[model samples]
Structure formats: structure tokens, C-alpha cells
Target: MNDLEDLPEKNKIFESDIFIKILTSPREAFKFINDYNYEKHLYILLFLAGMLRSFDRASTKNMGDNYSIWAIILISIIFGGLFGWITYYIYSALISWSGSWLNGKGNTESILRILAYALFPSILSLIILIPQIAIYGETMFKSENDFYSSGLVESVIYYGFFIIELILGIWSFVLCVIGISEVQKLSIGKSILNLLLPAILLIFFILILVLLFKLIN
Candidate 1:
């Protein structure tokens, strides 16, 4: 009886994500996730945009005198829209498979609603990403026929990255599934973003760094 009294209150012992940690392994990844809910999604979209944009720019710069900043920026926007659409599809499929409940509300109807709403951000973001690409694609087209002539090679390379990005995205989406199983409060917005964040570095950082090293050599 005395020991029971000495212990902390059962309610007090369990902090927000603590129960989450107990229920889930690989705790570290999911811990920081609970914060910044919607912001995570924003980062995902931006990081994806940044990754696609940076790579295209790097390739153009490597094209020697044909490089045009205006052209690069414009193309980034178009690719960004495409990346965003892919992100949306993958996220919705994985999140639904995981039995996600949203807005701190746990219900079947809420889960379906969340899936239905994902299109808002995907379509809306394109309004800007597309225009930005249009501008750059125009400059690129005007400056060099190589950019167009090399279209086959470029498509092959882009599609390669797209496949890699999709694989990584699915892996992260599974992480989110593990995360949701325990936390239950897994923010749909954040999980969606986390799915694509790694590509920013994998596609851009690693590729650009290698080029920089070669240039110095």
C-alpha cells in the first residue's frame, strides 16, 4: 500500500508520446515527428522541389556555356509539380494502408476525409511550380538546342531518379506506418512530407558534391 502511494500517478507517468515510444520501436525517428505537424509536409514539398531543382541546375551548369540561370529555374518549377503529384499519390496510398486517424480525432470517417483532402496541397502547389518551370524551360530551350536534343538522355536520368525517389519515399512511408501504430496521433501532413525529404540530399547534395570534387581535381 505504501509503495503504491510512493509511486507517481499513473496519468502523470505517461507523457504525450511516451506511450507512443513504448508501443513502437525505432523510437528516435518517431519522437521528433510529433512536433511541427503541418510544417513537416511543407518541408517535404519544398525539399522535393529543392532536390529536383538543384539537380537540374547542376546538370545545366555542367553543360558549359549553354547554362542559363533563367532556364534552370523555369525547368525546376515544372519538375517540382511532377514530383509533388507523385508525392501525393504515394503518401495517400501508404497512409491509408496504415489505418491513420487525423486531427487528434480517431475515427474511420476522419481517416477517409484526410485522404480526400490531400489533393488540395498537391494541385494547389502546382499553380506556382508549373509557372516557374515554364519560365526556365523557355530560357533553356532558347539558349541551347542541346537541352532539347539531349531530351532522351535527360528523361532516362530523370526517370532513374524518380524511381529512386519513389523507393525511398515508400520506405519512409512505412516508417510512418510504424510511427502511427504507436503514436496514433501521427500527423498526416508531416508523414506525407517525411516521405520525400531524403531525396533533397540524395539527388542534389551527393550529386553536386561529386561534381565539385571533380572540378577541383
Candidate 2:
């Protein structure tokens, strides 16, 4: 009887409320998530986020007339899932290592967990793609198709959905900053700096490599 009573307590670690809490009170949500190690659907979340990102990238380029919509989606799912997992580990490691310079307390696992949950907004943003695909089909991925010239109503719907997607993407970053701050025990400003540190170093390293290549040539 006591064991049965305790089951819910133990299983409550997997509660879905964290999804709602993450959006409403991110700091507390991240702290609880990190403390409890709530890692349910972590891979799925990352994979879907990666798919959305991949699809966005594909939409920008010309996919050509040879590819079908289903084929593109399949490729995005497979490649994007792989890319997401790889990038998640790399970014988490980079952030964890860089945070140490600022005396941060978070390790890679904790940062990874926080980042996974932080992507909730982006996962939700996937809904916007459905109607977009339904309306535009393969033309959505083709650069030659000018959507704006279609019609005012279609253009309005397209831009409206785009705006919502943009907001969600921005909010995902905001949640990321908040989660990092909670895990790293840094202020919001410092958290932003910690997040940017990797990109900054990568850019600097690329510039130096470019200079070296030019000199060698």
C-alpha cells in the first residue's frame, strides 16, 4: 500500500506540467528540470527542432523540380534528427566549457537538459509549417515561386504565420538564455554573454584560419 502511494511521487518526475511551466515561469521550470533530471522526450524535442530548422534552410534554397514534398520532408527528418543530436552535444559541450571560464556551475548534461526544454517554443512553431505546406506544396521550397504575388489573402496569411514563427523562434532563444542562467547560476546579462562566447570564438578562429590560408596562397 505504501509502495503504491509512493509510485505517483516517483513517477511525477515525468509530469507534463513542466511544458506549461517552462513557458510561464522558465527559471523555476529549468531549476526543477535540472534538479530532477527530467529527460523524457529530450531526443524527440531536439529532433523536431532540428527538422524545423532544416526545413527552414531548405525553404530558402532552390530544391529544384525533381524533388517531391514528401521526399524533402523525409530527408529533413533523417538528416535533421542526426544534425540535431550532433549539434546538441557539441553546443552543450562548448557552453559547459566556456561557462567554466566565468565560474559557472553547470556541467554538459545539465546544460543539455535545459537546452532541450528550452526548445519547446520551437517545437510548437512546427504547427505553422503544416498550413504553409498545405497551401504552397512544393512551391514553398522553390525560390522561383514568388509567394507574395499570389494574392492579398494568401500573402496576408503567409506573412501572419511567418510573424508568429518569428516570435516563437525569438522566444525560444529567450528561454534558452533564462535556462542557461539558471543552470550556470549567472545573471541574465552574463548568461547572454556565455551563450555568445562559443559563436564569438568560432568566428575568431575562422577569421584566423582565413588569414593563414591567404598567407599560404
Candidate 3:
């Protein structure tokens, strides 16, 4: 289906098939979303992603003794929202920077759209929370023995959700590649490089910092 043809009107961006298509087929979905107007969806998408992250973090905490449930919720919202927004800009900037080096012509708007929507998969990571809460109860994650100590089968099932969560995280990266490649007009190879170059540079810079620290000491 040509998702663009069935796109929601300006007043109802969330109601659009273009929104759903962002998950199933990001490449085509991004092309259409980029072609049309969907700026309002960006903040909403990022906020939802933040909430999911907050929920995941909350599930891992022990809300029994000193930690309040309300406090965890508030912290999650504030920290998750702050981190999520910062990450949005960082990714958008990184992709834009990489695009510039690759002879790709795109602006922050397109990069932001791709990166924000790419978060759809990570939002799906919240599904793992149900199993996590079931296993850990409302106690500290470090106190696993006090709750349900690990057995072979229990361990498999418990860790299995985390493995699924990790897979969803990777799936998000895959979607990012497709969305960024299409929006930035980059080939697949260049798109992969565009995504990886940031992490590579970050590691290189960290090593330099460590070497400098050692020399100073």
C-alpha cells in the first residue's frame, strides 16, 4: 500500500497510516513522512519513548525500603525525558554530520524525523517489563535471591525477555539505517558508515582521553 496516499490530514498525524507504516516499512514510511508534514509527531514520539524507558527502569528498582514508587516514577519521567531529548539531538546531529561528509545533502529536520521514528522498536521494549515485574517483584534488582532465586528454567525464561529486549534494540538500529538512508539520500553502505562513524569516533576519543590521563598521572 502507498502509505502516503492514505496519510492522515494535518490535524490528525497520529491517525495516519503513515504512522503505523513507520514500524512495518520505515524506508517507504520515512519517504512519505518526510515529504509531508509531521513535525508534531516528533515530540510526541520522543515523549512516549521516554515513558517506556522510565517504565523499564522502574521495573528494575526496589521500591520497598527507601525508594518510593512515586519518586521512581518522577525520576524516570525527568531523567528519561531529558536523556531521550538529548539523545534525539545527538543522533540527529551525528547523522547530519556524517551525511555532510558523504556528499549527502540533508538537514536536521529529516535526520530528526528518521531518528525519532527509529525509536519505535525500542518503545516495543516495554513489553519485556511484564515478565520482569513478575520475576523481580517490587524489590531491588540486586537482591534477586530474596525474591525468586534463579533455577535453570526460571533463569532461561527470565533472561529470555532481556534477550528479546536486546533484539528489539538492534531492530531499532536496523530501522534507523533504513530511515536515515532514505531521508538523507545515502546508499546502504554510506548509511551504515553514517551510523557507525559516530561510535567509532567516540571510542577513539575516549581512548585518547585515557591515554592522556595515564600520561598525566
Error of 2 at 120 (Å): 0.5
Give the C-alpha lDDT of model 1: 0.42
Name the regions of candidate 2 deviating beyond 4 angstroms: 1-14, 64-66
- Compute each candidate's TM-score over C-alphas: 0.28, 0.90, 0.76
Stretches of candidate 1 exceeding 4 Å from the true structure: 1-26, 31-152, 185-217
Question: How does residue 40 of candidate 2 score in lDDT?
Answer: 76
CA error at residue 51 for candidate 3, angstroms: 4.0
Full-model lDDT for every candidate: 0.42, 0.84, 0.72
**Best to worst by TM-score, what's the order?**
2, 3, 1
Candidate 3 minimal-lDDT segment of 10 residues: 139-148
Model 1 per-residue lDDT tens digits across residues 1-217: 1232343565234334332432354344333333212122434444454444444444545532454655555455556544544554454344444433333322332232232222222223334445434534444324243444557867565455446545544544455444543344645565544334444435788889999999999
Q: Please tell me which model should have the higher TM-score, number 1 or number 3.
A: 3
Which model is ahead, 2 or 3, in terms of lDDT?
2
| Candidate 3: regions farther than 4 A off | 1-15, 52-70, 138-140, 143-149
